[model samples]
Target: MTRLQRLVRIAWVFCKYRLDIFLPMAELPAPLKLFFLFAPWHLFPKGSLDRGDRLRLALEELGPVFVKFGQILSTRRDLLPDDMAESLRRLQDNVPPFASATARQIIEDSLGRPVTELFAEFSRDPLASASVAQVHAATMPNGRKVVVKVIRPGIDRVIRQDLALMFMMARLLERYWSEGRRLHPVEVVEDYQTTIYDELDLQREAANASQLRRNFNNSPLIYIPAIDWDHTTKRVLVMERISGIPIADIESLRAAGVDLKVLAEKGVEIFFTQVFRDSFFHADMHPGNIFVDASNPADPRYIAIDFGIVGTLAPDDLSYLARNLLAFFRRDYRQVAELHIQSGWVPPETRVNEFEAAIRTVCEPIFERPLKDISFGHFLLRLFQTARRFNMEVQPQLVLLQKTLLNVEGLGRQLYPELDLWSTAQPYLENWMRKRIGPSGLLRTLQTRLPSWLEQSPEMPQLVHDTLVQLRNAGAPDRGDRQAAITAELAQRHADRRWRLTLGALSLAALAWLGAEEKLVPLAQNMPHYGWALLALAGWLVLKPGRK
Candidate 1:
């Protein structure tokens, strides 16, 4: 269908199901409200469903990309209203598969081999169907059982069109919504586009799967199925077939006598291991993409599928995120606030004390309960809500991480309610932190780069001599223009440093305010007061020096 026709079809589906009813009647513009009331027959047909249900239906009808978007939004209870978040959480990945003949054609064309030649058996029926691709059971000629995943035919055109609409909606949102600027709807959509479109290429997904599999090479906690490189192509992937109970099929898992608690705790470990140890995580970790092997009931193993969407944090982002998470757990609101500024996630000019106080208000209540009792998802939501008050812009990269975390947390909770996420994650993070920053990390880096260093050492003397000569010539007073340029650069750098310091101070103040709520040790409480008084005392110290 043409992009326009697809949009029209979506609109018609919404109208037929009365999706507008879910929207707040009073909050909408007067004209839109009036139009909804007066043009019910034209905009919404009779016997319509609940507005939330209708919206879900319309998105599903639209296509996989839109449905995937809905799934991502569901994780952001922080950004969305309660009703919408709840409704969107119901967006399932199960969609009708393309014809078996179509799947055959895609595989044959991509691999340049007939199905009969490639596989001993290729099932006509799909094992499962999702928005991005469908899986069909097959056996390699070598007698290895595998699953062939074929990208849905014509999905790219649909995704591009839906993405265009998403951008348009994002622009409208930024123009109209009160929270648009803070929420950064357009950036969020753009991030989603990059993520979903990347999933369209089976080659990329296969590589991601291979890397993750290698990371956990001999690990018992998680299993990533081997990719059949010989049969894999840009549009078609052949992977080792795995047999396990779906992670969400609790009844079946229970019937198979899987150790639920071990399974749950292991899930948390697997996530931390992937993110902190491997620095690569499977971002799309919805229940459908996860399974559990109950073969060894005492030691349950997690089986992961759908490696299409994954995320990695930048070094700076990883450091700041770790500090923020640690600070929040310790109820050190000031540290959290300072970290945000230091990380540049929030504007540097924000007052640290005020931000700190806001964070304390949002987090203290949650801390009153045990980590097991606290809802990690709700905690994030509240944190974001508090951040919005301080003009904090949403971090699009963190959005995927947050969504995946929520899914993992939810799955863990369902399997084991008493699971202490803080306890489970803290040790892993601490170990990672130590290895990342301490002597061990330096040693590891040295070891890894030793060969290259040895290879380049022979040329180092000449390189250093040449560099020193350039520096000496550049510093020569005969070059007055060079001196002037150097001076100007230094001055600009100084100004930038001052601005950064101011931002640092502001962030610190926000953190102090947030951390002050807990009965701080008397000394810590007096520190801020002392710091303030020292500013006043600085003039006297300077005057004394001047008089002397």
Candidate 2:
């Protein structure tokens, strides 16, 4: 569709669903507010649907791009109201499949082979369909069952068109709305744009699947399908077909004698393992992307698919996040606040005690409820809200982590309503912390680095000697001072050389010390103070004059 036509359709959808009711009309421009007042949709009888439902419906009707947007928005429970977020969470990617002939054409064109030559049997009908791609079941000549995923035709153009509109809207919101600047609507849209565009590349998704499969190879908690790279292309992906009951089919699970409680606990375990142990997690883990292998009902295994999005944390972030979870479990709000500052998640200048109190205010009440009743997702939401008060800049990297956590929690609750997420996750966090920060962890780290340390050991003495020489020369006087006029030039040149040497030595030393700090005590409480002192000393030395 033309851009103008798309905009008109979007406007019609918005009015038809009366989505303006969700907006702060009072905060909008006077002209826009007046336009809303005279909108034709106002003529229709008000339905029983709530604002959230109306918004969700509008997005769904707007097409796959808007649906995807809603799905992403659903994850930001901290930023959205419970009802709105919950409603958006229900947004599913079940767009109508394109013609099978078109899918075949794309596959053949991308793979450089006809379907008959590529597979022993190929189904024209799609096994599943989504916004960006659709999957068709097929069998190889070797009789190996597989699925061929084809990207939607002209999806790139469609996405670009939709994204332009989104950007325009985001700019408008940031320009006119009071909360827009704080929310960073433009940045959010940009992030989404990057993510969706990445999704268009089937090769990247296949690689994600391959890495995850390797990470969980021989593991019983979850299963990832193997990629058929020989047939995979940027437009088409071929992978081993997997068959399992959809995770959302609770009735089927029960009928298959699956243990719901065990399933729920295992889900929590899998999530923590992905986040803390493997450090690579499938980010798009909604019910649709998950399934249950109930062959061994007592020990049900999860089957994961759709690896278009994944998340990882930097080492420091990983350590701090683990400590934060552990501290929260122990009800040590002070430590939580400290970790946030230490990890640079919150502004450095934030008052720890005040932040601690804010966290306690948000978290303590949640603890009053039974462990089984508390929702980790809601707790995180509250925590995010409290952190915002301290002007905590959102960590874009952790956005996927937060979203995955919410999905895991929701899946757990769905399987077993009385699931104690804390109990399931606490021991795992504690164990992870112990292995990461305890004596054993330290020994392992030392062992890993011992060879490198030894290799560099020979240079240490020379480094020390060079640093001392620089320090000594920085204070040395020019013996040519007897020749007064030339002495000044000689002294300046000498001072410059000495200054360069000293700064270089200091930099090397600082780097060495920082490396040691990382290996020795990654989450050390006093390391920041030591770092500040070093920085202060460097500043003084830089500003200090040489021998005059």
What TM-score does each of the candidates earn? 0.79, 0.81
lDDT score, candidate 1, position 372:
82
| lDDT of the candidates, in the order given | 0.80, 0.84
Model 1 residue 374 CA deviation in Å: 1.2
Q: What would the per-residue lDDT of candidate 2 be over residues 1-548, giving only the tens digit for each residue?
A: 89999999998887788776666677888998898888887876668999889889888899998999899988876567889998998887898999999998998999899989999999978989999999999999999999999999999999999999999988988887777777788888887998898899999999999999998898889999999999999999999999999999999999999999999998999899888988999999989899999999999999999999888888788888888888998999999999999888888999999999999999888999898899898889888988988887767788899999988999999999999999988898888988897656655675465445444543544565555455545665853344543444455546555654565464555446556667535634555785556545555555555444
RMSD of 2: 8.7
What C-alpha lDDT, on a 0 to 100 scale, does residue 32 get in candidate 2?
A: 88
